[model samples]
Target: MRAWRFHEPGNIANLVLEEVDTPPLNIGEALVRLECAALNPADRYLVQGQYPRAGAPPFTPGRDGAGTVVEVGPDSRFTPGDKVCLLGGGLTGVSLPGTLAEYAPLPEAWLAPIPDAWTFEQAATTLTSLTAWRALEICGGLQSNDTVLVTGASGGVGVAAVFLAKALGARIVALSRSAEKRKNLIALGADAAIDTESSTLEKEVRAAAGDQPISLVIENLGGPYLEKSVRMVAPEGRIMVIGLLADLTATVTIGLLIHKNIRIQGMSVNNFKAKEAQDAWTKIVDLYNANHHRPPISQVFPFAQVQEAFAHLQAGPMGKVLVRCSA
Candidate 1:
């Protein structure tokens, strides 16, 4: 088998294609022949040794993908030729050999059957949507009619958050730096789109929400947004932190917690309860089937051009970038 491997994690340049033996299937695991792999910011962070959850070096790098099951171990529900997509902790390429290769062994529990309406490229994006589902349903405790604010609303998780929140009947206020990208947010069902680069972000949000204070804040950027989120949330409101694209460090007003009874939480897609994961997976598929959610695909690179795909991911495209792993 041919797969991309990192001898030692330092930078993207360390990634190289090499011939390797097929990974043996463990109990409750299945061997998947990958058709499409999604490149995420975590992949870049893992290669740079910046992600906290990634494992030691000498592993393949990819978090999510869709493929056909080539073989299934004992006690697994999957069968040969079953179409599935992956979820869970082994998603980090540094810890386990992921979908960046032609084939990889994935836990049977982490694999979900792809919906009929979705292509492999579309199924490759399921993990991000699942993360959004967990953040809103479990971490943020979002309710219908609640006013929700999403930072970095143009990115993959951000866009998914906007769509999922809207489908749940929440009033969404989306924040993005680009005016053009804000249009994408509005199209994704955000009631109001605020330009984050604008000096009057706080005022704009206040005006958008009117009498309603923000009940939930879905923050994908950590730095400045984290600090501002503390001030904007309503009494007893929840703030879910999911990404760290901006600055990792945040300075928050401690008084806000005491005065408003706010709750701030950090969410990792890798850490999800079995029932919660199943519910989220079902919801996302239902939403997709209803035409309520559409995961954007900005670029598709061939497997041989893996380096170019990583470079493009670092360049910060508005939508998901994918690698077609098989012929």
Candidate 2:
């Protein structure tokens, strides 16, 4: 099988397509004939060797994929030809060969049934949506009527956060650098959209919330925004930090945090265990099937053009970029 492997991660150029032997399914695992693979920021980080996961060189770089079961171990519950999407396996682009190939071995526990309403492209993007859902619903303890702010609101995770927050009946304020993207956010059920580039995001959020401080902040960008996030959070509000796309090194004022009684947390999609991850994936699938929301597909790439798909994600987009792996 052909897979995109990192020869010695330094840049995107290090990702090379090579033919390798297909991995066999182990006990409790199944071999999936991948239909689509979703590219995440972590994929780029792994390819560039920026992530903390240690691995030998020439690893395939993808975390989430949707596919059909081609073979299953005798111990697994799934049979051949079941449509599924994989969750946490720690095999994408870092610790092991990932979904960047035509096939991948996934644990049965990590597989979620794709909703009948969703296409392979949508299912491939479910992991990020599940992460965002867990961040706001489970970890953040979001409640209906609470005002939530989502940073990086045009990106994959950000868009998911917006939709999930809305689905849970929370009032959402989406922050983005682009005006056009802000318009899209409003269409996605955001109460309001703030332009983080031109206006003071802290001020805009305060104005939108209107005497009510932001109840929860789903943050992806750090740097200056962190300081502002700390300030704008309501007393007893929770701030979930998921990604650092802006600046990682920034001085924060501890006094504000002390006075505001804010709870700031770092959230990663990989932090959840098997049972929790499986539950979250099921909830997302149910939501999609119920017509509550859907994952947005910004673009779809052929399996042969996985590199181009990664490049498109790096350029930034309104939703997840998908790479179709099945003929």
Candidate 3:
């Protein structure tokens, strides 16, 4: 099998494609012939050796993908030819021989059935959607009519968060740096879209909510925005921090936090407990199948053009970028 493996992570250039022996499926695992593999900012971190997952040289680096089962272990529930999406098995390009290759062995527990209506490209991006759904619905304690703010509202998770928040009947205020992206967010059901570049984000958000403090904040950036989010949240409002795209360190006012009684929570979709992940997957599948929401793909790249896909993502895109692993 031809796999893109990280020799010694320093840059994207380190990812080299080579023929490698395919591993046999273990008990409770199934081998999937990948059709698509989705990349995230985490992939960039992994390639740069910034991610905490320790490993020696020569490891494949994708985390989420969609494929068909070509081989299943006797103990697994899925049979060959079953369409599935994989989550949380550390089989990503960084940890194991990930979906970047033509074949991947995933634990049965991590596999979920993809809806017939969903293309392999869509299913490959399910992990990001699931993460956003989990953060807003489960961890954020989102309620109908709740006023929410989604920072980084143009990225993969942000787009999913917008759709999920809308489906839940929440009033959403999406913040983005680009006007064009803001327009897309509005179409995705954001009640209001703010250009963070020109306006005061806190004021804009507050105004959009009609002076009501934000009930929940789906935060992706974590610098000045974090401090501002702390101040903008209503009393007892939940602020779920899902990403730190901006500077990680920031000076915040403790007085504002104490006075407002805000709950600042940090969430990593990958860190969810098994039960939590199962629940999230169930909800995501339900939504996907019901046609309640769908993630927008900004672009799709062929497996050979994986580097271009990564570059486009790093340059900032309006939606998820998918790598088609199969024809």
Q: Of 1 and 2, which scores higher on TM-score?
A: 2
Clash pairs of candidate 1?
A: none
The C-alpha TM-scores of every prediction are: 0.94, 0.95, 0.94
For residues 243-295, write the lDDT of model 2, one tens digit per residue.
88887666678988888888989887777777888878787777666755678
CA lDDT scores, all candidates in order: 0.83, 0.82, 0.81
Q: Candidate 2 has which clashing residue pairs, if any?
A: 61-93
Over 91-182, each residue of candidate 1 has an lDDT whose tens digit, in order, gives: 43647778889998887777889877678898888667888888998777778979999988887788888888888889999998878878
User: Can you write out model 3's per-residue Cα lDDT over 1-327, one digit (the tens) per residue?
Assistant: 877888887988888878889878778788999998888888878888888764567878788899999998676788898999876434345565677888888777777887668778888886777788878887888889689999998998899888888777788999999888999999988989998665577777888889655899998888888998887788888899888888767777988888888888888776765556667777776765575566788899988998998999888778888888775
What's the best-to-worst order under lDDT?
1, 2, 3
What is the C-alpha local distance difference test score of candidate 3?
0.81
Superposed on all Cα atoms, the candidates' RMSDs to the truth, in angstroms, are 1.8, 1.6, 1.8
Predicted structure 2, TM vs. truth: 0.95
